[model samples]
Structures are given as structure tokens and as C-alpha cells.
Target chain A: MSFKPDHEIYRRRFSRNLGVGLCLVAFVMLGFFLTVEKVTRGNPLDALQGKPYVAAPVAP
Target chain B: MTDIQAQATPAEPGFGDFVQLLKPRVMSLVVFTALVGLMVAPVHLYPVAGFSAILFIALGAGASGALNMWWDADIDAVMRRTRNRPVPSGRIQPCEALGLGVALSGISVVMLALATNLMAAGLLAFTIFFYAVVYSMWLKRLTPQNIVIGGAAGAFPPMIGWVAATGSMSLEACLMFALIFMWTPPHFWALALFMKEDYSNAGVPMLTVTHGRRATRVHVLVYTLLLVPFAMALGWMSIGGPVYIAAAAVLNVWFVVGAVRIWRRDEVQAEADKYAVEKAFFRFSLVYLFAHFSALLVEAVLRAQVYGV
Candidate 1:
């Protein structure tokens, strides 16, 4: 539908909420990536590459 | 310019009203349960991937809420409790809500597939469809068994979270699903007992409106009794521990006592006291669901330290 002046506020509101939601998602993704990487001392993506973790060898 | 051309139109809504259309209240529950499901799963997700899974799942929840508002606008407009909601109040047009719902639904599903797996994405898509179309559009106005079957939409999130991490379904996932599904009738019907007039006035066929308060009370007690076993079973299963077991035991006793009290009261007593018993039960039901889920998280953490699962 074409925007009437009356519809402009809602349109802007919709656009604004969409931006906020997307930004929040991006922030979460970055936070998780950085924090988890720091905790594990390596890139988390490395785990998904068929190697989640390596175990130390058993003592003889 | 014509006289009409000279006039300035007032703004229809602010940013907050659009957020309301997405039902932030319900979305919070969805996000929390979905997060728990992801966290407690055996397969560990890269934290960013996990975040993406939750984000899309939340958007999917929001999408369903918007669509429900769009479809239920007619009933909502007449109900005293919902009369001022965004769609019903005319702050946002129904078509706008629909457009937003559809767009979010597609975006969430596609993004989830990219972030996780086809199973999780598919489950999310089905959940949105179930809530918006199957439940809101069909079951709601049609049956008192509405929430009974329709509760599946809400129940899917934790399962979706589980699937997001594990890429498969298991008994644990189904148990989580069952907990919400069974808990819904008592939760909503308690609200219905107090808000029967709202549903009646809106022509919605809620149990309290159709079956009378007496039958509704019995239904509440029966459902709570049934729900107790399942709630406790979650504690018995792998996802739970002593913390959960104790919480479920106490919550169930508290819930059953409240349900029993409601069952004993008649309409005369209810009106005189303004549905105090029923209202208390409804309030407790919120805590019941939240606490049970929170306890599961606690148990998961404890087991991680002890059993290393």
C-alpha cells in the first residue's frame, strides 16, 4: 500500500524496531563468539570442523 | 491546494506499539525455554552459532505472535482486556501486522537453517504455522480442547532448542514438549475462570464460558493432577537433578493444593470474593512454569559439575 501521511509513523516505527532487533541479534552473535573463544582459548569454529576438542593421552 | 491537502495527519503509533504486536511477554518465555534447551543439549554449539539459533527462534516466536494478533483483532477489539492492543486499537493496521508476521516467519526459518540444521529450521517453521494458523485461526474459536491441542506451539521451543544443538529428537525433547503442553490447560483455564466474561463477550468458546465454572474447576484440578507426574518426571530424567526434584515436588504440592481449593469453591463464593482462589492459581501457574524451567537449568549445571554431561 502507498504511504499516506497517516501511515508514515507506523512505517517508521516498523523500520526502527526491525533495526533494533537485527542489531541485538548481531550483538549477541558477536558476544557469544568473542566470549566463548576467550574461554576456550581458540576459535569456536575449529570445533565444528570435525574436532570439538582433543583429550590428553593416558599415562602408561 | 484543496482543503484536505492543507490538513496534517496525526501519527498513528510509536515504536513501542509495534513491539507490543509481537507479544514481547510471550516471546520472553519462548526465548528462555529455547535457550535452556540449547544449553542442556549434549552437543555443544559454538557460542555464536548458539546465539544465532536463539535469535532466529525468538524472531519466529515474535512472528507467530504478530500473526495471532492480526487474525484475532476482531475478537480482541471487543474483549475488554485486549481492546487497547495495537491491532485492536487501530494503532497498526491488520495488513501491516500480517506483512510483518509473514516476513519475520520466513526470515527466522531461513536464518535458523543457516545457523543450525534443517531439523531445527523445519521445526521452527511448523511452530509458527501451528500457532498462527492451526491454533489461533482454527482451534481457538472452535473448541474448549483448544489449548489442549494448541499448546503444542508453545511447547515446541525447547524442543526446537534441543534440535538446534543435537540435530535430532529424543525422549528428553519430547518430555520438555509434554511439560508445556500439559501445563497449558490449567494455566489458561485458571485465567479463563476469572476472565470468562471477556471470552464470553467476545464469542470465544473458552471452557469457562461453555462448561460453566464448576466443570472448569474440575478440569483444572484434573489437569494439574495429570501435569504433576510429567513435571516430576522431568526431574527423574537426565536433564534434572536433586535441585529440580525438590523444586518440582514443592511446586506440584503448591499447585495441587491451589487447584483443589478452586475445585471446592462454588460460583457464590467466587463472586463474593472476586475469584481470589482462581486468580491466585493463575498467578502461581506463572511461577510454576518459570520455576520448573529454572530448576531444570540448575540441575543441568549441577550435573555438569558432577557427572560431566
Candidate 2:
């Protein structure tokens, strides 16, 4: 089967961009958590004010 | 027609071309605002489901982006700012973008429904349609009010987030949507003010192009005034706290002042200044939304710690 020149070019570009994007995503995720730990004194979630933990009222 | 026949385009499609297809800049706003919506709502979902729902929301936003790119490739090619986007640059075919958009839209909406609720999924689907079809294909060329009405599509993410958690909408959630909706006109029109030539060249009916810069400036000032009260009301609703109220008050005062400055400036001064006032307001608008939402998060935290709302 003859390969179209444009198809090969598109495939190469797509793969390259996908690889770059994946690397950036990993870096951001890792950097974000690391920054959170360093800034929040090692309890990253602690820095976030979580939703209130309200228990259901008992039926009378 | 002549350009299409020349050498069949020899420039090698690069990695950046494909990345441009996703419209990363617009996607960031959707993700941030949606996350804020999810966080501030007075409801909860299981951690895994919540994560999945948000992921699907992001995909839906991406779908909208792809479709917008496919449809607007013609105008995008003409506009200097958009000329190098994936579709126009020949890195990706328009049909491929359309296929990706349709596939992602279906996946996102279905997954959201299963993970969250039907209502949230419905809203997400409508948002994608509104942006891709209503705004991009329909209103963009027909009316100067394009951004004003189309801004609703961008505004829906937060409300969808709130609905994802609560399975319904509330005054607080709607206000967040309204705040962004009203803010979009001035924010975009400001860019339009500076980039009027780009819109005119592309045959887009931006306010600055269709109605003239002076009229556009007045509209910016009017909308900025409207945004202030809506932003403050979020604070009053207990959706925010002292931090948010203070931030909104100060930001809004400065914002209005900026808009008024742009409005009152003489055309000669405005032309020389160009994007200065508008640019400041635009940059500040980014901080304004972030600060308001950050305040909400802070208020939520404080309430959790002290009053336990």
C-alpha cells in the first residue's frame, strides 16, 4: 500500500505534540503538589479549607 | 484560489500546530471557573465520581473548542491573531477536528450523566452546542451583540459544576454565572477596541467594528458598572466572607474607574493610548474573578473551621 506523504507528516506532528503535552501535564501535577507541601508545611490538603462535615440531624 | 495551487504547501507541520487545535487559553478559563463552581457549592459527591465529572466537563469544553476551530477556520485564517491555528495552518484537517469534537462531546456528556447526574450532563451538552453552533456559526457574523449573548456558553461551566454537586441550581450558583456573563462583554470588547482592525479585516461583527469605538467604550463602562453589584452580591449571600467582600469592593471600584477612564478619554487620546485602559481592565478582570472565587474558597474554609456551614 502506498503511503500518502501528508498522512505521514500529520502522524509525526500529532505524536510529537501529544508527547510534549503529556510531559507538561506530569510536570505541572508534580510541581503543584510539591509546592503545596512546601508552602503548607507538609500537609497540603490542610491548606485547603475542606467542605463542612455536617452530620444528618436525628429524627425525633 | 491561487495560493491553494502553489506547491501544495511545503511547510512542515510542527508540534505547536496540533497543540493550537485545543485552544488552550480558553480551556484554562473553563477549567478554573468550573473547579471553583464545584468547590464552592453546598453539596458533595464521592471523590472518584467528582473527579470523573470534572474531567468530562473539561473534555466537553475541549470539544467545543475543536468544533469552534473547525467552523471558524475561514475567518481564523484571515485574522492575524488566529491565522496560525491548527486548522488554518494545515496541521489538522477541518473534518478531523469536527470528528474529534463530536466524539468528545458524546463521551463527555454520557460520562458526566453516569458519573454525576442527568441535569449536569444536559447542561454540558447545551453549553457545547451553544458555543459551537449558536455562537460560532450563527451569531458571530450576524450581530454585534455576538459576544454578549455567546458569553452565556462560557458562563455555564460553573453552574454545571454547582449542579453536578447539588443536582440543582441555586441563587448563588446563578449569580456566579451572571457575573462572568456580564463581565465577558467588556472584557472581550476591550480587546475588540484595540483589535478592531483584525475583526474588521476578518469580517467579524465585533462591537468596535460594527458600532464604532466610542459606542463600544460606553458599553464597556455600562457593563462594568453592572458587574460590580453582581460581584458584591456573591459576598452578601454568605457564598463569600469578609475577605471576598473587601476584595470585590476594591477590585470593582478600580475596575469601574478604569472603564470610566476609557469612556471619558477623547478619541485622539484613546487612539494614542489604544489598549492601555482596556488592557489594564482586561488584566485586572482576570485577577477579579480569581480573587472573588478565592474568597469563596476562603469563606468555605473559615466556615468549616469555625461556624461549620
Candidate 3:
């Protein structure tokens, strides 16, 4: 019901880990976007307008 | 009846508690491998779809983690390493974790299927099941080989990522999976070696507890040795390059050396050192896997530029 001292410590560690994870996610996203932009040679936002919306093909 | 009724009264879950349920440290490894898999696969999805697929896979990983936290709450409460987990810490109720896990598992699988291919979605579903059921409920308590076998669940992300891109598993993907799978035992065993007392105290059937530290150390060395070829093989695959090969060679050797140090240490020395070997091995093992995968990623980028992959 209430947080203990160990709980506080875990929370701190969790927060720090979460920050690291978010930084990684950001780094990956930036890299992905930059790669996409480089490959397309066009603005990614502009490309999004014509983006195909195909449904997932069923597994065989 | 009275104690059962008391225990059945569910506690409320706050926002932070929900986040804690995900086992975010484990999720980071899953996310990294899955990202690499999607990145280097020959087939490409729209960037938007690719990110979405990875996100869903991450959610699926989190869901499985939540389920594991729920199922293992009892044991986790007893174990020093896990006692602070959300469910065990009373920050969240077990049933709530179960419900959240189920909901997110369905959402992730279905969303991943929609965002990418059914193959990736299917793999996500299976990973969740393997972790929640096979590893957590069955293997963990049943066998000393728990992490040895259970480690497979953690090893599937890259393969799933590759499938998300290519719509099928490939030789390269299998090699990537093998690298992680082989690395798991030693990585985990190193932790177990230091935490043998904790495992014994908690009554968990860890290899260190059941077979003794000498045996566990030997197994750790063996698995670390096995990981060398698998890591190197990834460098030989089409996805690999010279840089990757060089990196894997060095990292694997370093890893094996760490394992060997742990194996050769006498109990008196090990006790005098007090977690030194275990700590170094555990920390370096993390660096080792990251180096291998990062090298692969670097190779993929270099090849894409030089040879158009």
C-alpha cells in the first residue's frame, strides 16, 4: 500500500533505466528517420501523405 | 478461507506501478535486438510501419514481463534481486498485472501484424507465451536448467525483428538468435554464482544452488565458449562484415577470458574477492553482446553505403 525504502531505491533505479531506454529509442528513431529521408531523397513528412495503408498479409 | 479472502483483496495500481510491471531493463535488450533485426533485414517496410512494428514488439515484451511479475510474485518476494518488483512490492496487485499483460499481449500481436507482417506478430505472441508460461510457470521452478532453457525466450527478439522485415527467418537471423541464446547461460550464471546464497535462501532451483558453484562456473565457461562460434558465425553471414568479424572475435575472447577467470578462482580467493569475478563477468557480458550486435549494425550501414547491401 505504501512505499518502503527499498521501493524508493528501485523507483530511482527504474527511473534512471527508463531514461536510458528512452534515449536509445530516440537515437534509433532518429537514425531510422534519417535513413528513410536519405533513401527517399525527399521530406519524410511529405512522403507520409502518399503512404500506403496495406493490411497485414495473413501468414501462410 | 480467512487468509485467502484477505489475500484476494486486490491493491490499487498507480501510474508508476504500471511502468514498473514492464521490467524495463529486460525490455531495453529486447528493443535493441529487435531494432537491429528490422534494420538489417533485406526487405524493408515503410519507416513509419517499421517503427510501429518495433514498438508493438516492445509492448509485447513488456506484457510478457508483466505476466512474469504476476506469476513469480511469490518467489520474487523471497528473492533479494526480485523482491522490489511491482507486484511483490505491493505497488500493484497480481490480478491487475495479469489483466494488463493479457490486454497488451493481444494489442501488441494484433498491432504488429497490422503494422508489419503476420510472421512478426506470430513470433511476438509466441515469445509472450514462452516467457509467461514455459519459462516463468514451468521451467523456473521445475529445473535447474531454467535460465539455460528459459533464456531462449529472451533470445527471440532479433529473429522476430528480422522476420518483421523479411517476412521469414533466415540463416543470418538464426545466427543472431544463436548468439543471444548462447550468451544467456553465462550471463545469467555469472549472476547466479554471486547470488547463490540469495537463490538458496529463496528456494529457487538455480544451477548454482542445485549443482554447486563449481559446476555452475564450468557451465558458464562452456556456454561462453559456445557463444564464440555463434557470435563469429553472425559475422560470416551475409549480414556480417570485416568490422563485425573483428569485433566479435575480440569480444568473444574477452568474454571467455572473463568466464575462465571465474572458473579458475578458488573458493577462498572467490570469497575474499566477494563478487569481483561475478560482477566483472556480468558487466562485461552486457558489453560483449552489445558490441557484437552494434558491430553487425555498423557493418550493415557500411555495406549499405559501399555495396548497396
- Candidate 3: residue B180 lDDT (0-100): 90
True contacts kept of 2: 0.18
Clash pairs detected, candidate 1: none
- Model 1, A1-60: lDDT tens per residue? 875474576687777778778867976676566456645545656666766455658899
Residue pairs in steric clash, candidate 3? Answer: none
Q: Model 1 - which docking category?
A: incorrect
DockQ winner: 1
DockQ of candidates 1 onward, in order?
0.19, 0.12, 0.07
lDDT per residue for candidate 2 within A36-56, as digits (tens), equals 544554444555776333445
Q: Candidate 3 chain B, which ten residues in sequence have the lowest lDDT sum?
A: B4-13
Report chain A TM-scores, every model.
0.58, 0.57, 0.57
What RMSD, rounded to one decimal, does every model reach? 6.0, 8.2, 7.9
lDDT of 1: 0.89
Q: Rank the candidates by DockQ, best first.
A: 1, 2, 3
Docking class of 2: incorrect
> Residue by residue across B121-178, what tens digits does model 3's lDDT show?
9998999999999999999998999998888889999999999989987899988888
